[model samples]
Target: MRWAACAAGVGLALVPMTGSAQAQEELEEVQEARRTLLMAMPGTPVSSIWGLVGQLGIGVEHAVGSYVALVGSVQVSGALQGTESLLPGGSGSSGQTWGVGVDPGVHFYLTGRAPEGLWVGPHLELATYHWTVQNEYLMGRPDVPLSEGDLVTVETRSRTVQYGGSVRVGYTAILAPGLTFQVGAGLTALSSRNTNFGTPRVEGGGAATDVEGQQLLGSGFGPNNIRNWSVSPRMTLGVGWAF
Candidate 1:
């Protein structure tokens, strides 16, 4: 009877120890799941196809905690100038357009943890664009005599800046051990300003004033010259590796 009693005591003592060990294992698993540190993804906006422009972007997410992450993106765009039709009586028009932008945000995971599953966050956007064009046209100088060979070559340059904020909701899926795919959408409220810079130079004819040169180059080359505010929809698609 004493031997049986000692055996029961040993078994009973081990029951708690086994439970404690299992609890510890489960805790370790939770810690492991939350240990994700960083994820980098190259992505682009779905609407980038508009206006025949091409954009390249890289997105990064850094886990700050179990449910929160810091996210950012750097983007660049390029396109052939599309302002020939808008220029007044201008020919041989050629130009290039380009832009750079950055988006910074914080993501709060509603499901799973940082850098994975579904998440929502608020983000800020900042961007700048530049356009340069050279074209030949008659210099509209009222005081100057007109001639068939009096055409002037004018070069115009313009720039624009935009800033805004938006809230985004996205889903990130782990396709393989370290591969990730993400999609997101948001509505952004943006404020923009455009400016004509670097006085346009005139060659081969009568002198051209800066204002006249800008007008000849056309306003459609960039954003409106006035301060403007608008709301626009934004989207993102990306594939990357997550460590």
Candidate 2:
């Protein structure tokens, strides 16, 4: 339509002129521009990666769990000052480390209805299993007789059989019709304290002095222990089939 108007204007200009050929040429250019403009299509590729929008969803009388262990690491700045523990044998050290737990547990939703997209109920986990980091070292000097490197490695591991519960609130977004994407963040008030880090276990020493696990057991990390009052900031991402 706009090209038609341009052609009419060009024709009027030629009415007082002598060259019909020139007027036609200008009209052709306008037509070409219009055709190109009309042919343009949308260039955006439709995508729904990780569900761009936020949603709330609650699971009623459903099985709940933690996909990944709440791995955590802490630092000692006030009393004990160490960024991290040296890898057994002084290779490297870190303050703390956490491992995965192999305890499949389930819980029920307390929110009578939808619960505002949250499963506000209690969770009963079987046991909390953690990863282990341990190494050994000799004491005194390795080359010297009855004298090892005087090196002592550290062994860190933890596993606890405890039950705990927390109020969970998560949001679910309906990406398609029945398909839904959800993310949840909540706090856990655990009855049994779980350890994110344990005391360093130093072993091996020279003939004169042998560093046992007790020696390395600092104020915090200790041999076989349960942790508690830990604030775990959790995030959940998964697809759900809503019936």
Candidate 3:
């Protein structure tokens, strides 16, 4: 009877120890499964380090599962513009442009893990831009063909709003704990509307002062242009941080 009582005591004592060990193992497993949210910045601020050009943006990534994540970003940028003379001798017609844009995007991670290592994903983006174009003519100039005086002969202006959306496949590599680089290419569909002003306004085939507000590859895309629907190629390269 004493031996049986001692055996019972040993078994009862081990019951609590077995439960404690299982509880510790479960706690460690939970800790290993937990993931941290990551925040990042992409754009000229980050790419400037590599002597590359990039847009400004704030991005975030959250792991929904061990292998999948959700990502999103918001971006704003200024448009580049320049003046070009269309007529003769630098005294003819000239055009100037100004613009600003905003972009927002969402993505789903499909490779490796969220906010770390190598990842490839599909994403969608919406972009909007507001732009202005001004047309000015030189008056009474000897180099110009038909000028009244060396003054403002004619002035016309136009404003445009462009909106676009794109679906892209992107890849990112996290080289270090808080650093990453990305590249993406896609096709975009865009639409634009324009508002014109001034005396000699820009119209098709009959305007003297032509105001053009489109550009591509760092130069003019064409003459006074706003398209209802268009498709174009888009590409991006950037460096960023995940923290």
Kindly report which residue pairs in candidate 1 clash with one another: none
Error of 3 at 41 (Å): 8.2
Give candidate 2 misplaced runs (Cα > 4 Å): 1-122, 125-127, 135-148, 154-156, 193-227, 230-235, 240-243
Choose 1 or 3, whichever is better by lDDT: 1
lDDT of 3 by residue, 116-211 (tens): 444545455454434344434343334554534232333356666667677766676655344667676677776766555443433221223222
Best by TM-score: 1
lDDT string, candidate 1, 122-231, tens digits: 99999887877777665555675433335667777877788989988999776445677888898899898878788766666544444565565564345437587888
Deviation from truth (RMSD, Å), model 1? 6.7
C-alpha-based local distance difference test score of model 3: 0.51
Model 2, span 48-125: residue lDDT tens: 111121223223222222221111111111111133334444433332222222212232333322311334333333
lDDT of each: 0.72, 0.38, 0.51
In candidate 2, how many Å is residue 29 off? 56
